[model samples]
Target: SQQGEEDPQALSIQEGENATMNCSYKTSINNLQWYRQNSGRGLVHLILIRSNEREKHSGRLRVTLDTSKKSSSLLITASRAADTASYFCATRGPPGYSTLTFGKGTMLLVSP
Candidate 1:
């Protein structure tokens, strides 16, 4: 079954602005991960926040996880036109499950 669903079907912003996207999941998860996809390219893993960790940052990316709410948010600071892409969140189900379920994704457009 699908586990994660991202909020905001789409987003549009200018370069240098900040873009934030959210994801909500249905089941308990061991960890949540964010990824970015450029056009037809493969997804690029951005950051992974474990259940035990509430927040994490990687370069221009910030991620926050609220286990009780079964939600997570991703923030991209100083966005650029190159940052235009689709963002997806993935969740790792409880133990014994080897696969991760990904959300539908939020399509972001950063205009120059």
Candidate 2:
């Protein structure tokens, strides 16, 4: 079954501003990963912080996890037009199979 779901189906932002998106999961998981999809390109791995980790940051990306709430948030600091894309969150099971289940992403548009 599908596990993760990102909030805000679509977002429009001005260049140089910030963008924030939230994700919610349904089941107990080993880890949650975030990826960025551009137009017709493959998803680019953004970040993968495990269940034990509460928060992580990578350059302009900041991720926060709240296991109690089964939710996570991604914050993009100083956004740009090039950042316009779809962001998805995936949940990885704890068992032997490491397949990732993805959610319907949030389509972000950054105006130049």
Candidate 3:
């Protein structure tokens, strides 16, 4: 089974600070992707790291994956109130499977 679970169900921080979240999964995966969702909106793709990759970055987002440990982490640098949202980690199984298993997500609240 493919499953991903995120840690620290919730996080609170002030604007300009940093927020970090972790995810762990069961079974092998081809790639791991991170997404962000506003309170009443669809999820937005953030970044993705392949199994062969150890790290990846996009703008203010940084992601690290450790296949050996079956884990991944997301780091948001220079947080903002507008950045407050739910962050989720999703995993895609081998090539033939187009489905993605998403984690419960971590709610991040940023105050100005």
Please name the candidate that would achieve the greatest lDDT relative to the true structure. Answer: 3
RMSD of each: 0.8, 0.9, 1.1
Task: Give the worst 10-residue stretch by lDDT in candidate 2.
Answer: 90-99
Which parts of model 3 are misplaced by more than 4 Å? Answer: none
Residues 8-60 of candidate 1: C-alpha lDDT, one tens digit per residue: 97999999999999999988899999988999899999899999999999999
Write the residue-wise lDDT of candidate 3 on 1-112 in tens digits.
4399999899999999999999999989999999999999999999999999999989999999999999999999999999999999999998999899999999999999
Please say which candidate is ahead in lDDT: 2 or 3.
Answer: 3
lDDT per model vs. reference? 0.94, 0.94, 0.95
**What is the lDDT for 4 in model 3?**
94
What lDDT tens digits, residue by residue, belong to model 2 across residues 1-112? Answer: 6688899999999999999999999888899999999999999999998999999999999999999999999999999999999999999978676899999999999998
State TM-scores per candidate: 0.97, 0.96, 0.96
lDDT score, candidate 2: 0.94
Ranking by lDDT: 3, 1, 2
